[model samples]
Target: MTSQGLHLIRGVSHAVFRGQHDDRAEECSFRFWRCGKGFEISVDGRDVNHTEFHLLWHQLVDDNSLQNLSRFDKWFRLWSEWKTLRDVLHCPTYTLKLAKTGTDMRVAAHLVAGPVDKPAYDMLPVHVSDMDNFAKGLPVCGSESVRPGSWLGHSPGPVRGPDGRLYTLVLCEHRALDAQRGEADMPSWDRIRAYVHLAHSGVDTHCIPRLSSLVTDGGLVAGVLIDHIDSGSSVQGLVEAAVSAEQLLSLEHKLALWRDRITLTVTTLHEHGITLTTPEYGSTIHELNIEVNQHDQVCMLLSFGTVSIVVGQAELEHKTSDMDELRTVFDERLPELIVETRRRLAAA
Candidate 1:
């Protein structure tokens, strides 16, 4: 239902906003699509202003507005209700504008919703000594053993610290800054700091990696220091190995235990207002550590970037439902994967 000439960003398609049957064309309130490098949008066929569109985008996605409804539906309801009343009174229709500056789009919507001012990401500066100390005398922010380096494929680097504990430094990526800055697909370093702040204020710390310190340079966030999670092994590896033996009963038991643990993990996350995306859970289960902490074994959810703070129970339920669906797919596939593994193993 998108109007012609609307250029969508890399990872998104017009079909997302347009309902299956084109029922959402006019009914939708806003049209802000995520682009690979920036956003391409058309708000009511009017020239979209930078500031208002930015505010409106955040208002739409952040406040649990994108939970159950499609983007179009959510924005439409809000705009329609407000517009109907405003139009009847013969008021001018305010537009959401997008200002593009060298790959950065700045939109202000303070007049309609969200914070009165944009957040300025200022924090402590990151020093060479800090990186060296955290990395146990290793190099900072690049590839080398025993050093702090960027993790492969869109992740921060994990480093060994002087305290004999592992740490990871999450910094701002160029794409996230100059491109998708402010979109929920990739959180700003400041927002990550906010999540850390929330965690420090008495959320369940055991379920997540321990955040150690904030790394910055020149008053801007350079990176975040998170405790590196150590694992005896991963749940996925264990499950897959068990499945390779073709022991149905064992596989079933493993699957059951995984179901329980995953449920518990999801519960703990919800209790603290956190939700994990699909890549952070199902596909990345191999990254989750099952390690012994003190006298007991614990599960550490890795990759904070894949998580988000939900608005309410509704959003939480929606997120939890997605996790559960992924679990179901894994459960159904295990039997077949087990058979495949067993055949290959036997042949070997």
Candidate 2:
């Protein structure tokens, strides 16, 4: 989307503060813009010295102190602390309220002084399209129809799309892009597109999260929306619970079933010319999600993690290595977990 398109979706307002700091009169004004769940605040005084404010802001960000404080408290400290900005008036308190317009939400800032409550100030809503300038020029397949929605919770969680389906937005990691490489040549995009291909390759998608759409901003690929998997339903959680309960026989039987399903999933991916990249930790079993049917039988083995497309003959080694590592997990890790659980039980 262009800047003009962004302005169509934004709301703007201004506010001024006047007070005395250390027996000296002070005054400052600020411009606030609110757009698509983002807020931008800018100081608007012409002759005001903002050296102290900039230094204090950098200090808070460097030590990560601002992250520990609430959003309102962060703004409050930045605006009200005289040591941070002497030219700015110290406002004692403030109130924040949210107003909803259809599916979109807007925030209103109100300054409170003693017994008086000032009218809520409107802020310009900055366009969400400006968030990812680095990914500009990367081709996005069918991204024109994909509408990014507000994050459901913390990032990497499900985001409700315009289609009303829950999707996990996987942002392209910065490290995946090489400095000398063009954005279109990034391996991350290739991996993402490979997954999208696998989703529609007529294989059983029950064991994998299907790629719904690619998220883009300003014609650049920013991220992808994939089917959301509940982390609570992972096979690791089930195995740990079975070990704690000392259901050795049942645990072994369930693991056998899961192993077979995983084997089939790996085979399917290999056939599609995709390689399951072994994570840095080397355990793929933790990424397996399980869903049981009404008859209490394991129904699905949802694979959730990183994967890459097999390009060269040398990259084919990943296929065999992935299978071998999974086998080791089932053969060694499962028994070790059982032994540890029993030892702890006996000691207790």
Candidate 3:
């Protein structure tokens, strides 16, 4: 049991963690309940003649630390022991039930799912080309023809290009692009060209998605097609999952590496006179993607969206503030974000 899980159990007047026990003979439900100063554990199935249950019962009975312990201490001991048993037995799913003291209060049930499966996509080849030729000869596809995938909501989805290679299209709203052009006095296509040029010019092109071609609809630039990331999660999603599972401490080193990768990538972009636009501020996490392998190695990738070429002093100041906010998020504000996520989970 984690400290956060123990805290939750202590705060609630009554709580229970229930799940199915691993049994080949018969399906059974095992429950652990914490009520006031006492606890109750039960197992129900068609066939209850298993030795595993008896073994667990005997193990708990033989444990002297659980005897004469305070309410919180005893519950903690029991939870830790049960969790060990559960993991060894391969019981994956659990439901946590929490209730207040008042009879009028309803018991809140939260189903804690097992390990999450990474997002899946069809394995496809990526088409890479120079930005100038790619943009010039790019085909215009109707927005209605493209279907969104699980990759990044409705914006980017895997699409086969003219060369029959798979790529993801990031559609830009024409109105928004025009607004940016009016503000910056630079065409949207020019900004994208400069951004892609800088990304390709870097020694580490792995962190940036490869631009293949631009997609357009009715003369307006709809989006650009970039290489598809095989198995990736948004940076925001990764952080939220770590916070939810209370694994932040164990994975802190990995997270730090990811942050550094992102910082280095952005710094490289800034050095090339490319900075994120004003609208992209405070939401840099969503623009970043990461893939972790079985060996625990991480590959970071940047999804280009709403970037501008730094032309003057105003743009330089904008870039400075953006970098500052990026540092603040990964460095100073991460703890607060984790706490806030925990609070939301508890409230829910």
Candidate 4:
């Protein structure tokens, strides 16, 4: 069951953003990883001639000094790697077109070599069992189980790196063992992996999870090491717990802060020609992926999976749709939460 495709890199990373705290001590850990040639990447794995994608994110957006030229220069370096890989392998230019589905998405990979356009790769559906196998086989992180980030399910492993930083490991949708016994309504890792890369390549480090590695089993993506947020839970979790009127009111400033953070984050993504879709629950809580700091400030926004890079008019129109959805999520949900909290308080 060796996959000759992309995979996620195992383990966690402790990323320190520059110029945060006065003593350069205002460090927050984020996740990032690179793709290497293997069926499964080890914790100490390194991709030859490959740069960490998340580092590129930090370099581009975290620093205020970088100009548009600098950003282009940064992307040029990354494009060089892809170009080299393509040239060395004599591989055709692959255009992976993904379309949405009811439960998962369909990936249509086409090879282009000067007017010779044809199908290239198989569109395999990644199952949760494959993710479980990926987690079970990876080297155990210090002081944690094989599936460490299992709290959120879908087989996210927890790892405590040598640097003592915690991280959550997820199965990359692009690569894994082809399950003989299929699971129903399985999520697509192909789209998920693309979203992870987009988050690393599109958004800033503060508003998104740091991707540590793109772990692969030679060709397919096997697993991914992402930042483990040890901060407070999602705003949905906070609202759900607010049973008193006073407690709900206390969330006013926090909600405002979160809304502002999300708005800015979404706006920044849009500025980069990317659009993020809103969650179904009007919240990232459906995935419990949003992280709030102890001070009730949003450290990271959610739904990296929903990010789409705009290209033409159709995609551009999506920006307006996405923005409106986000506005509704942020503006409308607070009042409902307040009302629910008051009802709970009165009932008690």
Predicted model with the maximum TM-score? 2
Q: 1-348, model 2: which lDDT tens digit per residue?
A: 001111111222112211112212122222222321122222212222344443433332232231221222223322221221101111232322222223223222333223222111211111235534422343333333433332211224455555666666554432333344433233444455565566556577445566666665434454567766554444555555553455755766777876787777778777887765544323333424344433444433222344567667745777877777677767876677767766765676
Worst 10 residues of 2 by lDDT: 1-10
Model 3 weakest 10-residue run by lDDT: 117-126
Model 4 spans with C-alpha error above 4 angstroms: 1-157, 160-164, 174-203, 278-289, 300-305
TM-score rank, highest first?
2, 4, 3, 1
Estimate, for each residue in 1-348, the C-alpha lDDT of model 1 and write its tens digit: 322112223423322232111242222343322211112233331333344454564343332333332333323222221121111112223223333333344433323332222111111232344443343422233211123321211245555444445676555533333332444344444335434644456455554565666544433345556766555555445545553454645655655655566567666665666655543223223333333243224454444434556677655665766576546545655556656667767776
Q: TM-score of each candidate?
A: 0.44, 0.51, 0.46, 0.47
Model 1 weakest lDDT span, ten residues long: 81-90
Task: Report the C-alpha lDDT of model 4 over 324-346, residue by residue, as the tens digit.
Answer: 76666666765676677778788
Per-residue accuracy of model 3 over 1-348 as CA lDDT, tens digit each: 101112233354222322233433133333433321222223333223334443443333232323232244433333322221112112223343322224443323334442322111111112235434544534445433443321222344565555656677654422232444454323344345553565456445445566666554434445567776665455445556764445655555676876677677777777777665465322333324455544554444333334566678967876886687676667666656666666776776
The local lDDT score (0 to 100) that residue 35 gets in candidate 3 is 24
The C-alpha stretches of model 1 lying farther than 4 A from their native spots are 1-154, 162-165, 175-185, 188-198, 240-252, 278-305, 312-317, 346-348
RMSD (Å) per prediction: 16.6, 15.0, 19.3, 22.2
Candidate number with the higher TM-score (2 or 3): 2
Report the candidate with higher lDDT, 1 versus 3: 3
Which of candidates 1 and 3 is the stronger one according to TM-score? 3
